[model samples]
Target: MSNVGQHLLSGGLSGFASTICLQPLDLLKTRLQQGDGSSGPRFASPTFTCVTIASTSARNLTVFRTARDIVAIQGPRGLWRGTNATLVRNVPGIALYMTALTHARSVMAVSPYFKAVQKYPSGDSRTRQGSVLPTLTMQGNLLSGATTRVAVGFILNPFSVLKARFESSIYAYESLSGGFMSIVRAGPSELFRGFLASSLRDAPYAGLFVVFYEGLKIETYWTSHTTSAGIHSFSAASAGALATIFTHPFDVIKTKVQVRSEARYHGLYKTIRTIMTQRGIAGFFDGVSLRLSRKVFSSAIGWAVYEGMLMLMASA
Candidate 1:
């Protein structure tokens, strides 16, 4: 396969693996973010009420309990309720994001302003052991990560809306195509419901993730004089955790905007006001643990597999 093709394959495989492994966490996060209808317009559907009842009790909304409730209500497969939508969104979404990010970094690396200072030999640009991609300056990492992520995010946001609704109890979408058509019928506004909030979350999250991941790898090498896939995984996971925490509020708002039909959630400022007024400061952190867990493992597994595949392909 060509380099771009390899990047796509590698990213798709990584996304598939991570999504499958971490799907339950994603479902829980959606349910958690969906919250109770108490703060907004309540759906009249019994299914919505039932699902909300399972996780709405302040004391009973723990992740384990919510997960158990899902299994009780919809059987074991309930946890993977949105697997198809997630796969549709994440597989190509991750592939495009990775490819765009790689291309951006590669292009930037050739520019003197973004080029990494070479402290080692020239043939292989692997400044540190197990680092396969071209290293750029911190500014390069931030810019490339932010711009590429937002662009890919914008392209795949319709699928993102589908995925969010699929995971939430608010929508009873019969099929992926059906859900997609529903959004289409709702018009372009619904298709890009949370684009602004999503962009806000993704831009900084991607930028900081790259900056922290690269910085951690370099720092680890400097401190321990070693680097490997293990170190890369650690760095990526740590970076993901930090970035997830920082950007989680926007995530909550984005989920609300996409999944709920209430007028309160129809706009960014209104959603913020509703969350703060109803759920307080802690509201923004809803489902944070589940998101953190999923992001950490996903980042670790995804980046490790992506870089490893690229390295193998290059060596071959």
Candidate 2:
């Protein structure tokens, strides 16, 4: 299959998987960010120590219980909250991330400056010649991560707004006009509350993902001699799990700003500080267990799907 087709198939399939795994959290996350605080009674602790739904109470259903309650209250429709906006935002976001990363790695490997930097004896050059590849590659890694996010944000910024608005109240999807108008009225600036930080968060995380995934594939194929699709899917899942850790705080902040524009976050700094003082560092890791599950499924399934699609398209 063509590389492009491979990416599309893997990415889309992984996205579906991730979505399913994370949907429950997405439901709770959306409501929590909107300050629903309805999970209070379910919690054993009366102090209301944290803003995350998981912190409040986890008895009978705990976070899962709250999730079920939400489903019961909102119906089956509720579980898929913000999913439309997620797709709209993530498809292009991921595309930009992966495509830019592929190009960056290729460029770093072939740069004339890097090639010239190789130290070599004419006879033994191939074996002894070390090059500036690592330095340039790291540079490429950072740039690809940052620039791609900025590029993708143009398309996804709107969806970020949509997801926030969609989950702001159940009224969001029920009344399309109101949802559209809410976003329209927020002004462009509000639509992208933490653009710079979000960019920072996405770039490194995604770049590392590319580095890890490519590296692992090479290692696995070379050592085990495995070329199976299942292996590739597993590699993708592993890379995704790693990316989730580094990028999660930004994810938390992104959700917050998108859902709670009235909360008054002037910038990433203030936003983080508020979360720390008001919610503590644990705030940065809200619903992390759920998020990890989502990422693994999404990455794994996305890889399989995207690969399968590539094979189909290439054969066609």
Q: Which number leads on lDDT? A: 1
What C-alpha lDDT values do all the predictions have? Answer: 0.85, 0.57
lDDT, candidate 2, at 58: 22
- Candidate of highest TM-score: 1
**Per-residue accuracy of model 2 over 145-237 as CA lDDT, tens digit each:** 556667777656766666655654423354445555665675787666666666766767767775565556445544553434665677778
Compute each candidate's TM-score over C-alphas: 0.92, 0.72
lDDT, residue 181, candidate 2: 60
- Model 2: weakest 10-residue lDDT segment is 42-51
